[model samples]
Target: MPLIVLCGLPGSGKSRRAEELREALSAESGGERRVFLVAEVAAGEGGGGGRAALRAEAERLLSRRDVVIVDAGNELKSFRYELYCLSKHTGTPHCLLLCPGGAPRPDRPPLEAPDSRNRWDWPLFTAPEDPSEPLPLPEIRAALFERRPPPPNQSTRSQPLQAAGFLHQLDRLTQDMVAALMAAQRNGVGPGQVIPLAVEGLGQEPPGLLLSRAVSLAELSRLRRQFLSYAKMHPGEGEENLPQLGSMFVQYLNSNLL
Candidate 1:
């Protein structure tokens, strides 16, 4: 069984997808292989860089199960590499599911780079003057407000727009993922691979837009109609836009077997 790692930003629906993967894998196993899910937060690990406990739990789960799913915002290159190392040490096949997380909203401030925040085991995006120090707010503000900072190598450079920046983050994340997975595969991890799965509208609505308290039935109907109209306009993009977790797992297994 392959150790599947769910990587995405916050509110990216990784948890739900992880649960889906766990259930799907369990069903496919038919009581023969145990499926375990280890969440980074629930592991009670203290803070960023405190993944030892989480890693230990994953190792233990792997020992008892045929599949282990790691649910976390593995946005940093280093963290993904660490998982690769863990798979190598434990002798388990590893595959990464990279969720593009949802679309960005224009109203909110751009999300700080995952590395900019020290909340998780992510590598920091630091200034060139001091690699350990985060880029100053002035630099970040210049990038975000001025709409451009500098070139790629410039530590202060940011994406042209928030959406562009998020996409860029995904690009960098996927690149690192491929590098790590390739290394793992070379070292004998079974089909160490990366899959891009997008779950649309994970956290698009704000509290005011939620259905329970404020939203009326008429408003909901309008939203539904709007969605239907949009879908009709792009009929070819049907449900095929993103494969379900179960279908993806099945495809992975089948490909490996072949």
Candidate 2:
């Protein structure tokens, strides 16, 4: 599903373009695609409506698996941003269509133009003034359908670390923790002892969990290797899920220690 947002001043022919796009998209897909049109949030006094209400309506429509065309004067950049966020959150494709046909009122805020510099405003389109110009079907199709991957965000790009890097770190981190545990064992720790977990860059020890009575240097090495193998094979070992590697290893060791 893709959300096509129409933004411009009132009487800017946004409604016309929205309907035309709906028709063209439907006919082009041989009615296979469920095309929808969400008119302005409200035809209230002076054509004013709360952005919250509009966003809520758009979000509800976008949650469904339908190609939605928001027919409204999305004059504010913030309003468009909301639409963009909704699409991203729903994992749906989206683009902005600027219908530049109406005059701005001095009584209201001026329209903040869509800038290509903004990622959310990309794949932007401008409606032809003539109203008879053909739809940019090729461009629209490529933008809405070609990009199958979800858009990246702050959380996704929080770290440059990828899966391969995470796996490498996983191996190194486990090796270091295991070494620390083995060194603790050499200090004459007995059965039912709690291991003092320490590693490079750690200001404090990890959880002081009970160690197994059967724990030996050789046994710890074997268990560490086994855990490394398991971690590498685990599907959920993604970079973002590895915030507490030391703690995770400590938990793993304690679980097996019992």
Which predicted model would earn the best lDDT?
Answer: 2
Q: Give the top-scoring candidate (TM-score).
A: 2
lDDT string for model 1 (1-258, tens) is 446666666666767767766776678569998888899777763343235566667767764247777886655443444454455445445556555445444422233333322212222222233223332434323322333211222122442454344434333433333343334445544433332222231123211111112223443344333223222221222232222212222222221222
**Candidate 1 error regions (>4 Å):** 102-258
Per-model CA lDDT versus the true structure: 0.44, 0.68
List model 2 lDDT by residue over 9-54, tens digit each: 8778888888888988888778777887877645232222344456
Residue-pair clash count for candidate 2:
0
RMSD (CA, Å), candidate 1 to true, equals 23.3
Q: What C-alpha lDDT, on a 0 to 100 scale, does residue 252 get in candidate 1?
A: 23
lDDT of 1 at 4: 63
Give me the runs in candidate 2 sitting further than 4 Å from their true place.
Answer: 41-49, 152-258
